[model samples]
Target chain A: MAKPDLIIIGAGPAGMAAAATAANGGLKVHLLDDQPAAGGQVYRNITRNQDRLTHLGPEYTKGIPLADALDHPNITHVAGAAVWRIDDTPTVWYSLHGKSHAIHADHVLIATGAQERPVPFAGWTLPGVMPAGAAQILMKSSDLLPKDAVLAGSGPLLYLIAVQMIEAGQPPVAMVETQTPQMMMRAVRHLPRALLDRQQIFKGLAMLRKIRAARIPRYTAAHSFKAQIQDDLLDFEFTSKGETHHLKCALVLSHQGIIPATHLTRSAGIPHKWHKAQQCWHPDHDTEGRTARPGLWVAGDSAGILGADAARAQGVITANAIICAVRGLRPSIASHVNAHAINHRNRAQAIRAFLDAAYAVPPEINTPPDDTILCRCEEITAGTIRQAIHDGATELRHLKTATRIGMGPCQGRQCDLSLTHMLAAQTQRPIATVGMPRARSPVRPVSLGEIAALEQTD
Target chain B: MMTDSRFFRRENGTYDTVCLQIDGVQTHARATDTVAAALLAFGPAPTRTTGISQSPRTPFCMMGACFDCLVTIDGRPNQQACMITVQDGMCITHQAGFRPLEEPHDG
Candidate 1:
């Protein structure tokens, strides 16, 4: 296969937009994703989910056009491809259909998107406790609804899932909000700028109203939330406004917002810096998504925790940048797309600050009680991590060597962010100084058989 | 246990159904359904057990991030049920604890 001019490694909002824009610019583009479809997690199953479009809302239906655009003749779309290794030579190795394949590209775009921040508390590894985003995926992909579900934690997604569930005729039993009144007050300062996006603000208010109308026992100022498995059911308990409340439910879905999934970028030897406000490490990139690496670019949530709309805008801007470089044209060539994206993205950023403040991941959720399991794969506890730190394991890599905190199949995708915060708090250091565990390839786990087969085919 | 049939069904579109075997029982599922979704529609039973605690677990993140939904399919251990789509006559087992690793032999 001939090397494509550009390779976009995720078919989500950013990736699809980048592919479409670059291909339309007369560049040969290759777009690959692990999912069987084009839409990333947010717009997953957009085509097949026509039956449940009303339940999923407009945010989902918008993905249909993006998915359709991926079918552009100049773009080669590959689905169900698990990219395991990206080398400095700018070659991407992915395993698909039980075989491995490699492709070289002049420019690579990392738009892998984000994942729900891991919130580890007591009994989080229990059968019934899960991230609220996971519940949303089930509903989006297969229309699976939790029969007796309780939504907990603090974020816009928490309420969005609750409202979606209500639309599905299976409203959650209750919602336990971890945000305090003080946080809302702090967020109020940014409301003027946030309200500029009146449609989003109104949508949020309507969801809140619907939740109230549905009478889904909403608790505010909820903290110290814990879940335990008792006789095949989840016993969820939390403190709300000085009162300890307990509820038995079949499922406990929790969320603390999302963070950029930087594993791919980090593994590719790109530089990352901690965003203090967003509370996560993002790839060090310029406004046009150009990283320090000569031929690589980072866009979408992978660069930072921007939402899908901003991701789409950033994708267009990055593609324009890539086109300028590939065609040896001046940066001034794509100035129009850059200007429009910058304006749209700045608007999104205005509201993001308020959302970040209003639904910040609680400190307690990040550094759970000592005995809480920190790493689900290794079953390592927060106490063990603390012990490792006390033993002079100052950095994440040091802690991994001492306690094996992130040496699991999931490759720290589930625990890295929480561990970074936990380490910073325990050692009284800034989160950026604490640093993240060094990323290694293959970024995703690949079977030995697949690796061996690659050699034979070569 | 109440099945997911009443809770989830295609409202307007039609898709072909395929038969698969789950834990020794024959089950019917849509071709578009993922392994996790097919098993979920059967019931809310635990899909697998934890490696260290031996506690029951289900599909937490329907995406590939969480490894909670690992199951044995077609004799391959530790396959992500959420990532793979269902196919007719495929055999799946609810994994319990860790599958002992096989010793490597000289090539």
Candidate 2:
């Protein structure tokens, strides 16, 4: 196979849009996604699930065009390709069907996208507990739904899922939300800018209305959320409105918003900056999605926690910038800053500011109790991480060494936020100062056979 | 209308059901379903026990971020049930803690 001029690492909205934009500009584009289909986390399995999940609403259907655009002759969409590393040779290595393959492109785009923030709390690791978005993924991809699940967390997504379930005729048993009315009030300051994207605002409002219309029980200002198995179901407990309550249900779907999945970016040695509003580390990139590393770009949620629409627009902006570079043009977004996609991105980001303020991960969730397991892969407890911090283990590497955190296959994806916050809180420093862990290669676990196959290629 | 099952499979989905065995039980999952989703549709039950404390775990993240979904598929221990798509006749079993490190692997 001939090498492509541009290789996009994910097939999400960002990656797919970037591929179409670049391919239209005469670039041979290769787009790789880990899932069996396109549609990143947001529009996951869109091409197939679009008709099946009409209840998920029009926003879910918006991804259909993005998936369809991959048919452009210059764009090669490779699904089920788990990209684990981008070596300094600028070679993108991914494992497919148990074999490793490398693709060389003049330019690389990492659109690995976002993951639900792993909130550590008592009994979070219980078998019946899962990230609320995980249930959405299962529904989107596997045509399954969560029944009698309690939606717990702090994000618009929690409500969206509840509405989806309600539309399917099986609303969640209840919603125990951590975001208080006060948080929403604080977020009101960004209302003017948020109103610029009135459509999205209305969409969010519609979700809330649907949830209310369905009368799914909602508990606000909830904290101390925890769960355990009882009578073959999950018993969820939390303190809401200064009163304690316990609800038994078949499952507990937990979410605290999403953070960029920066494993591949961090593993590739790209610099990252911590977004205080999102309270996570995103790759250091410019307005046009250019990264610190020349010829490599990051767009979409991986660059930050921008929602799907902004991600699609950012993809266009990044692809245009790359096309300009390939053509030896100015490579500046200055001329088209007001273009349709650009304006859409700007508008979406405006609403993100309000969302960031309203649903910022609660401090209690960020800094879990000592008894909570912060690192699920290693089964390491928060107390162990705190003890490591107390022992002057300042950096992420030091904490890993002291408590085996981030040493598991997840490579700190699930534990990085919690560990950063704990180290910062214990040492009286900022989370950015405490820092995210230095992620290594094989961002997702690749079997030994996959790695060995790389050598056979040479 | 929704079914009463916790991990309920909805009707009129894109793909027809493909069968897979979870711990020797005959279970049906969508052809496009990942082994993780397969187990979840069959689960709320423990898919695999952890290697460290032997604590039972399920597919928590559904995305690859959480490794709790690791299960033995087709006699291959420690396959990420979320990463691989479900195939008809695939046999899946729980990874009791860690796999014996010397188990053979495929490409």
Candidate 3:
């Protein structure tokens, strides 16, 4: 096989758009994703789940065209491929169908998308509890609904999932929201800029209205959310408005918000800084998605927490930059498509401040109480992490060594965000200074049989 | 057996149903269904037990980030059910306790 001019990881909104744009400009692009299909998490199963289009909403439908455009002759779409390593040689190594393969490219774009912030709490490891995003994936991909489900935690996605469930005729029993009144008050300052994006404002309003119309009981300013298995059924409890309430349900879906998935980027030795407003570490990159390292670029939520719309726009801009460098053209040359994508991205991102302020992941969820299990793999509790810190484990790496906090199979993907916050809070240090566990490969667990099956080739 | 009220097949869609074995019980699922979805539809039982604590765990994040959905499939232990599609006649068993490491052999 011949080496492609460009390789893009993650076939999500950003990677899909980037591949199409670059391939159209006469570059051979190889687009790879871990999913069985082209659509990423947001647009997952867009082409296959045709029976439930109305239930998925318009945001999902937009992926249909992008998935189609990925079929351009110059773009080689590789699905069900897990990329486990990238090196300074600018080489990409991945495992596919139980075999390992390597490819070289002049440029590589990391468009890996986001994952729901892990909100650890009491009974979170129970069989009935799961992230709201997980429930959304089941509904979108397999048409699985959460029977007798109760939505909990805070963020736009919580509301979005509630609305989607309602549309599908399986609304949750109630929604337990964690955003406090003070947060809403702080968000008021950004309302003027937020309203400028009339479409998003109206869409959010419509979701809220539907939830209200469906009469799904909503508890605002809820705290101390917990789930317990009693009499073989899941029982949920939380404190709202200074009153504790309890309910029995079959499923408990939770979400705090989302953070950029930085495992691959961090593992590649990219520079990252703590994003105060978003409360996560984001890779440092310029407007056109060029990273500090040459021959590499990052677009979409992996770079930061920009949504799908901005992700597509950023993908276009990044592809333009790549084309300019490869063709020896002036960087000043901005095409009409590039200008439009920039405007759209700017408009979409204008509401980020308001959204962040309104739906920040509460501190309690970030650093759960003592008994809560912080690491599911090792079964380590919050108190264990705190004790590790008290025992002179200052940084995340130190804590990992002491308590094995992130040494499980998931490889810190499930615990890294919350662990960083807990470390900062317990040690009285800034999150940036506390730092995250450095990402390593194989990023995802690849079986030894698969590795041995790899054929040695140049 | 628990009824799968959460998911229903679209009658008009042209998709085939495949039969698979879950814990020695025969179950039917759509060709497009993932192992996690098929197991969820089959019953409300936990997918597996934790390696250390032995606590029953189910699919927490069906998108592959959370490893709670790991199950033994076709004699292979610790395969992510959410990431793989269900195949006809596939045998799946709930993973329990710690999975034993492969014994080393002299080269």
DockQ winner, 2 or 3: 2
Off by over 4 Å in 3: A334-337, A456-458, B1-14, B102-107
Q: Could you tell me the C-alpha RMSD of candidate 3 in Å?
A: 2.0
lDDT of each: 0.85, 0.85, 0.87
Indicate the worst ten consecutive residues by lDDT in candidate 2 chain B.
B1-10
lDDT of 3 by residue, A357-386 (tens): 999878898889999998999999999998
TM-score of each: 0.96, 0.96, 0.97
Indicate whether candidate 2 or candidate 3 has the larger lDDT.
3
Report the lDDT of model 3 for residue A391. Answer: 83
**Quality of model 2 by C-alpha lDDT:** 0.85
lDDT of 1 at B56: 78
Model 3 chain A scores worst on lDDT over the 10 consecutive residues at: A449-458
Docking class of 3: medium
DockQ of 2: 0.61
lDDT of 3 by residue, B15-73 (tens): 78899999999988888888998888788788899878799998888877888889988
Model 3: DockQ score: 0.54
